[model samples]
Target: MQLLILMVVLLALTTFGFRLGRGRAIAASGNNPRLLHSLPRYHGYYVALWSGLPALFLIAAWLMLEPSLLHSAVMSALPADLQGLSEERLALVYNEVRNVARYGHVPSTDAVGQAAAGYIGVRDTVFLSVAALALALAVAGLAFARKRIEVELRARNRVESVVKVFLVLASLAAIFTTIGIVLSLLFESLRFFQAVSIFEFLFGTQWSPQMAIRSDQVGSSGAFGAIPLFTGTLLISGIAMLVAVPLGLLSAIYMSEYAAPKFRSVVKPLLEILAGIPTVVYGFFAALTVAPFFREIGASMGLSVASESALAAGMVMGIMIIPFVSSLSDDVITAVPNSLREGSYGLGATKSETIKQVVLPAALPGIVGGVLLAVSRAIGETMIVVMAAGLAANLTANPLEAVTTVTTQIVTLLVGDQEFDSPKTLAAFALGLVLFTVTLALNVVALSIVNKYREKYD
Candidate 1:
């Protein structure tokens, strides 16, 4: 509530400064915008930026640093015995103090209640002091900006320069974030590799990852072979692609080349609606409806099939990903130049022949791109696989067998509270790094295909 009120106050002041700055600029130019170096609105915007930006940056920095500073101060003021406690115990005490201060919780002892009171006093004082400083700086900026506003001032240039700097900072932030993610995954995977052989992880056929707590425990050293995981992931994703690609491409073709405009409009939205449905809903469908149905069908045929099989999960995943392929393919096919079709027809070619030879070839790059995206989606899917495909990492090409994908295993490994020092927890990062590498390789392959077949038109 306090932060919101501060924001409202700052916003109101910024607006008032904008109006005042614009009025001052016009008055300086004798009420003639043509006489001024920049428009009145530019002067207004320039002052508004000055009045708001610094305070916002200050608030953001303070909020980020506040918790650590508060923790240090409160811990230093604690009894010497409490201060000497282990780091974990001290952290818990700090959390208890914050809870007492915020929630009016009854502390175990009077010392805790007093600490909480002191924390509240310190927090409120610092907050108010910072808020006052922000307002002061905002007012000073507004005054300086208004004074600088004149016929000779280039307000537009100054505002645009600030915007350009903001854009550069935003780009650098994104780049640094990506670098951080890669480094974290790499470092954690390295730690995991220190415990398990990379060769065994990559090639050994076994897939168990249970790490024993004691030497006497059964399965003391768990199998970390990832071949079964890789196999299962490929099997499921391949099945999904087999189901999605032909249906999606054929539907897209029919819609783009044959359907009436009204029919096309209605059908396209209906297809895209599949994409809007939540993945969890699809997982439910796969688990409750599709899996049982498939199991019964297999039983009737006197064929063995697991209740939780890859086929059910893969089929449902394909249904979820159909829009990725059909929507993009339809758009690309529609975008193909009509001149090619006309030329093919002029050569006495039929409509189907023209589509097959001229239209499809022209749109091949985009179709390939869409298929690549669908493949990625299928590979990354977890909910449906978890619900319908059991988490038994079986190395089999048969879709009827229970299997698990890399993503499913990653989620399972990190589902609850875990000690990061253990190989089991760190294995998740290794799986993630491998998944990232595979995704990058797929992208490189897709880019090569797209560049090779990309068509240029005059």
Candidate 2:
């Protein structure tokens, strides 16, 4: 709340700085705007940028350091014995102090009360000091910028340079974050591979991660084969593609080629509305509605059907992915040049023939790209598979049987209170690495195909 109040105060001050700068520029120009190099608004923006940027940078740095500095100060003041607590115990103590400081709750004991009181005092003092310093810096910046607002001043160029630097920093931050995550996963997966062989993890038919909680507890017979996991993922994704590709393509064709403008506008949004529905809701519908429907149909035909089957999950997943294929395909198909169709018509080709020879071919790359995207979505899906397909890593190709995919297994292995040093937890990282690699490969292949066909179209 204090931070919010400080931000609001700084915002008002920045607005005042903008008005001050604009008024100064106008006064310096003797009310002749042409005398100024840049527009009056640019001078105002220059002051606003200068006034806000440095103060925002200071506040950001203060917020980052304030917690750790306060934590250390509070801990140093603790009793010698209390200060000797383990790192985990110290963390708990810090949480208590923070909770008390934020909520002003009465501590259960005198010791805790003293710590919380100390934390509150230090936090309030720091907040006020930092807030004062930030405002003073902003005011100084405002004055400097206002004084520089002259006929030859290039305020807009300076502002743009600052913006470009910020954008580059933001991009670098995102890239470094991704690199950090991938490196962490790679390192953990290497640890897992030390316990279990890469060959076993990749080609083994069984995946029993729970059987080994400790390094010494692992048995040679403990199934770590990831064949079933890979197979299950492929089966479900293949089934999803079977359902999605045809239906989505047909819908796209009808919407783009056959439907009138009014009908297309109304129905397109309605179809795409399915994409907006949450995956959890789809999971619930699949488990309660789709699974039972499939079982009943199988029973009537004297066939055995698992209560939780991949077929239900894949079908539901396909339905979820339909919009991706339909929407992108529609856009690409609509983008097919009218001259191609006209030439086909001039060559005595029928409407369907022109569509088949010219339109579909022209849009084929985009259609393939969209289907590849849908395939990725189907492969990464967790909730629908978890709810509709059981967690059994059965190595059968039968969609009627219960099976689990790599993503579901990753979730299962990482869910409970397991030690990170154990093979079971490490297996999650291994599975994640494989999933990442496979997704990367798929993206490469998709991009390659898209590029190849794009050249022809271009």
Candidate 3:
């Protein structure tokens, strides 16, 4: 509530700054546009940025740093015994203090309650002081900016420089975030590897993570083999790609080449609606409808099938991803220059022959890129597989049997309050790392294909 109030006040001040600065610029320029260095609106934006940006930035910084600083201070002021406690115990103690402060209820410990009260007092004091300082700075910035708005002042350049810096920071944020995720995955995976051999994890076929609770437990050998998982993921994802590629590409080709504009507009959105449906809904459909249907058909054919089979999951997942392939391929195929089609017609070639020989070849790179993206989506899928394909890591290529995926296993291992030190929990991280590596490798291959084919056209 307090933060929201601060934001509202700052926004009002910024608006006031815009009006006052524009008025100041007009008064200085004698209400003549040609006399000013930059437009009056730019000067207004300049003052608004001055009035709001510094205070906004400072308030954000203070909010992020306040909890840690106050927690440290509260800890320091505790009794000798509490101060001497281990870090973990001290953390628990601080949590109790926070609870007391928030609820204003007596804690089990009186000392902790007093400290919590003190924390509340100090926090409120600091918050009020900072809000006051922010308002003061905003006022000062507005006054300075309004005074600086002259016929000679370059407000446009100053505002654009700030905009340029903001854009650069936004780009750097994405790059740095990618770096951070890779580093975290790598470190946790290294920890898991320290406990379990990477060679065993990659090659061994058995997949039990809970059989070995303790290293010294009798007849309890822990198995962390990931080959079964790899095969299962590949099998299901390959099935999905097989279903998606031909259907999606053909739909794209037909829509782009044969359909009229009005018909295309109506049908395209209805087709893309599949992409908006939640994966959990797809999972429900697979589990309740598709799985049983497949089982009955297989039973009639004298073939036994599990209630939850990879075929059902992979088929539903393929249907879900078809929009991805179709939409991108449609755009790419439509982007092919009309001159090529015109020349093909000039050569007395049929539309089907031209599409098959020239158009598809021209759009192959983009189509491949879309297909690769759909393949990644299929591999990363979890809910549909979990509901339609049971969590049995059977090392087989058959799509009609129950098989689990790396994503499903990762969710299963890390769902509860399991300790991170256990191999079961750590296994999730290792799986994530491998998944990341594989996805990165796939992206590299896709980029290479795109670049290779792109150069031919250029």
Candidate 4:
């Protein structure tokens, strides 16, 4: 409520300052407006920016730094008995303190709460001091600018420069965040590589990650071979592509070319409904419905099939991805120039011939892009594989038996209790880095192909 009041006051002051600044400019230039430089609105905007930006920036900076500083102070104030606690234990204590301070309810009677109140007092004092300073700076800036708001001042140009810098800073922040994430992943993957050879991890068969928990333990061999996981991911993705590409492309073609307006209005939305279905629901369908059906069919054919086979999960994933491929391809195909289709028809080509030879070729790049996106989706899928595909990593070409994927293993390896430093848990980060790289490469290639085709048409 206090924050809201402060914001409202700031907005009112800025708006009033803007109007006042513009009025003063107009007055100085006399009733003859032709004598004024720039426009009245620009002057108003300049005053408004001056009234709000500096104070807002200070508030934002204070908010970001306050929690960390407060938490550190609280940790330092902990009693000597709590000093020997592990980092995780200390974190738990801090969390309890925060809950008590925020809601006046402690989850436990820990000593952390006492220390937290002290920290909270300090935080409150610091925040009040910062807010006062910000208010004073804003007042000083407004007063100084108002006094300097002569007809000759270049306020418009100055304000425009400030706005441009603000926008550039916002863009740079996003780019820096992405760079930070990629660098963190790279460093962790490098650490995993130090523990396991890249050649073995990439190409070796067998993927039992269970290893000795302690150096003194005997009979421990940690196999880091990821071929099985890769194979399973490929099998699932291939199956999804097989199902998604044909169905999605055909649907896209019909919608874009042949379907009547009424039919499209109904069917397009119906297809989109598939995309909205939660993957967890798809997981259950793969487990309870698809898996059982595959098992029954295999039994009738006298072929061995695991109850939780890759085929069932892959098929469901295919079904899930159909809408993604179809929606994107449909838009791309529809966007192809009508002139090309007309030329094909003028050349005595039939509808199917024109579609197959002319329109499809023109839209092939986008179709490839959509298919690549679907493939990436399949590779990263977790719930369906976790529920329907077995946990045992089987490095084989046959999709009928049980298999596991990179995503599935990552979930299994990190679920429940975990030690971040252990190889078993750290392997997840390595797998994630590999997955990220693979998907990124696929997107780049797909986009490049799309751009090349677009250039030819353009």
* Local distance difference test values of all predictions, in order: 0.89, 0.88, 0.88, 0.85
Spell out the clash pairs found in candidate 2.
204-225
Estimated TM-score for each candidate: 0.95, 0.95, 0.93, 0.85
Per-residue lDDT tens digits of candidate 1, residues 122-170? Answer: 8998899889989998998899898889898999999899999999999
lDDT (tens digit, per residue) of candidate 4 on 1-458: 55676678777878887897788778777855566666776777777777788888888888899888888888888888886799899888888888788778854766766876886698778877876877776676677667777677777788789989989999999999989989988887888888888898889788988897676644166888999999999998888888888999999999999999999999999999999999999999999999899899999999888888888988999999999899989988988999999999999999999999999988988888888877888888888888888898898878789999999999988899887776777888889899999988887887787677678767
Residue-wise lDDT of candidate 3 within 211-274, one digit each (tens)? 5657786426678999999988998888888888888988999899999999999999999999
Worst lDDT 10-window in candidate 1: 449-458
- For model 4, the superposed segments whose C-alpha errors exceed 4 Å read 1-41, 68-99, 106-117, 144-160, 213-219, 300-304
Greater-lDDT candidate between 2 and 3: 3
Candidate RMSDs in Å, in order, are 2.0, 2.2, 2.3, 3.7
How does candidate 2 score on lDDT?
Answer: 0.88
Q: lDDT (0-100) at residue 456 of candidate 1?
A: 57
For all candidates, the clash counts are 0, 1, 0, 0
Best by lDDT: 1
Candidate with more favorable, higher TM-score: 2 or 3: 2
TM-score of 4: 0.85
